[model samples]
Target: MSAYYDLYETPSPKGREGKKSLHARVCPIKTYTQDEFIKHVAAFQLLPKNQIAGALTAIIDDLCDLLADGYTVEMGDLGFFSTSLKCLQETDDENDKIRAESVTFQNVHLRVSSKFRKRIKHAMKFERVHSLTRKQKKITSTVEERKKRLVSFLKIDICITRKEYIRLTGLTPYEAMKELNDFISQGVLRRRGAGRSVVYVAGENLKVE
Candidate 1:
């Protein structure tokens, strides 16, 4: 069944080659842009166009205003939403006062109720795809670099038998397995297959590693 996935599976070396696509929805993460928000609202239960637009605009505005005012807006069963302080300033007054000087949005904290999340996930299956921007790509690269470095220090080069890689990397078998798999997807490492026959080997040297 189709559902949102955060992490996509890396190609598995072990094959029932052509048996199934290696990709799996491990975890799904997404950030909505203005256009996406509009499309999402448009998909809501049939409401007059004006009313739907107004309602969505109001909700977004409310969230923005609440965050600007330093209030954590809670969406009941959905989740807690808030802005993070980018910087704080101390008041010279006798009272120790620290005020948020600037704010930055991290990510929306969402905990959709099981029922709602499931419904949304299923409904979103046929939605059109979206691509990440260059800036996002850079940020992702930086994070992956860090992960690779961690993997390297942990000595997670591929070509090693899975068992041996896990033993040396100090990662639980699953984690070591994941790192090696990611490296494969990113073209940093290569994998041979699944289970005991799986082989991992470093594809290249990255600074992080």
Candidate 2:
């Protein structure tokens, strides 16, 4: 009955670096297709379904044409639609020259009118829905589990390669290396060879208990 939203950490703007702050993003439960959308409009208005569909199709066609023709379309309180341009070949060099053909409309944007925003705010009730948020990517294995898996693999082979260890346990390259070095210091895994040719062998502490 009410709108649902979830908190998401906003990305830092370009050229700026700081701790990110959270923002509310709406969670849409279902997506309406063209037919479903038209049916909904027919339910709300006195117009026939066919007439509403035809009018909607014509409005979309003309909106696209007018926007392409370089005119901003104003849809009453809904907002203003305008286009923005981008150069095909971008460069930082001050001497570099760009041609007309190189520049093209990159995107179409809409600025929602305050009247429309105010109306929505007045009519809608928002609820925080935590389940709508996507879980962040991360390594899920515990420190002991990772160490145990590596120790087990080294027991089966003469030496475990860095690449094989990474595949066996989904640790990133940096994490794998850091853990491998830590194991070496703890006498849990012995470092063999060097650089790209490096491999790991069982150490004194690696004895299974």
Candidate 3:
């Protein structure tokens, strides 16, 4: 078995005029090394590998410098970069359409400082937002919150099983099964997967959603 292999037993699809089913399955995420990512970026940018690498490194250094000095850097069409919260002046009218008073972190600005303006002659490297800046934590947090809602929805004492959930939710067989597994792990639902699977029936003693 592969080192990352994980196995899950799914519910059966037999019986109940209209019901859902589950099956044994496993899923794995493809891991990408940093070198692999850089190669892809270099190819996409149509630039020599070394030039792309140097450009990326320099941009990161500049962002770090601005952030360290507690000054937000706003690049006209792009967005601003700064610490969590700091006062900033809005010089560009780029956000005039959306009420000029505020800007969001999602947008990016890429104006280089005047000091470095004359130093870089050729192309001056159009600043890019490297993939490293992505905040996956927010996405992960969202997924968890949705899982919590799923658990609360299933916590009723009305004898709900993985099969019934799939049928009611209209979720694909795989999605229903994955949700069930997540709820089971969260201790909001229980299951016994043997020859025939059954979702543990919660009694009145168990809290209902």
Candidate with top TM-score is 2
TM-scores for the candidates: 0.34, 0.54, 0.27
Off by over 4 Å in 3: 1-33, 75-78, 85-209
Across 26-144, the per-residue lDDT of candidate 3 in tens digits comes to: 33223446565687676656778887778778988897787766678775434566565322454557665554345333333455665456554433322111122223222223445
Against the reference, the lDDT scores of all candidates come to 0.53, 0.77, 0.51
Worst 10 residues of 2 by lDDT: 128-137
Candidate 1 residue 150 Cα shift, in angstroms, is 51
What residue runs in model 2 are displaced by over 4 Å at the alpha carbon? 9-22, 91-97, 132-209
Angstrom error of the Cα, residue 198, model 2: value is 66
Checking candidate 3 for backbone clashes, the offending pairs are: 11-22, 75-109, 75-110, 75-111, 78-108, 78-109, 79-108, 79-109
lDDT of 2 by residue, 30-92 (tens): 567798778667765656999988998999999999999999999889999999989888799
Best by lDDT: 2
For model 1, how does the per-residue alpha-carbon lDDT over 1-209 read when each residue is reduced to its tens digit? Answer: 12223333367576546544434343323345665556545555444556766877899899988877778777766766766544344445757654444434455454456766776666654212122211221222344554545466546443566556545545433444555656655776655554346665556653323
Candidate with better TM-score, 1 vs 3: 1
User: Higher lDDT: candidate 1 or 3?
Assistant: 1
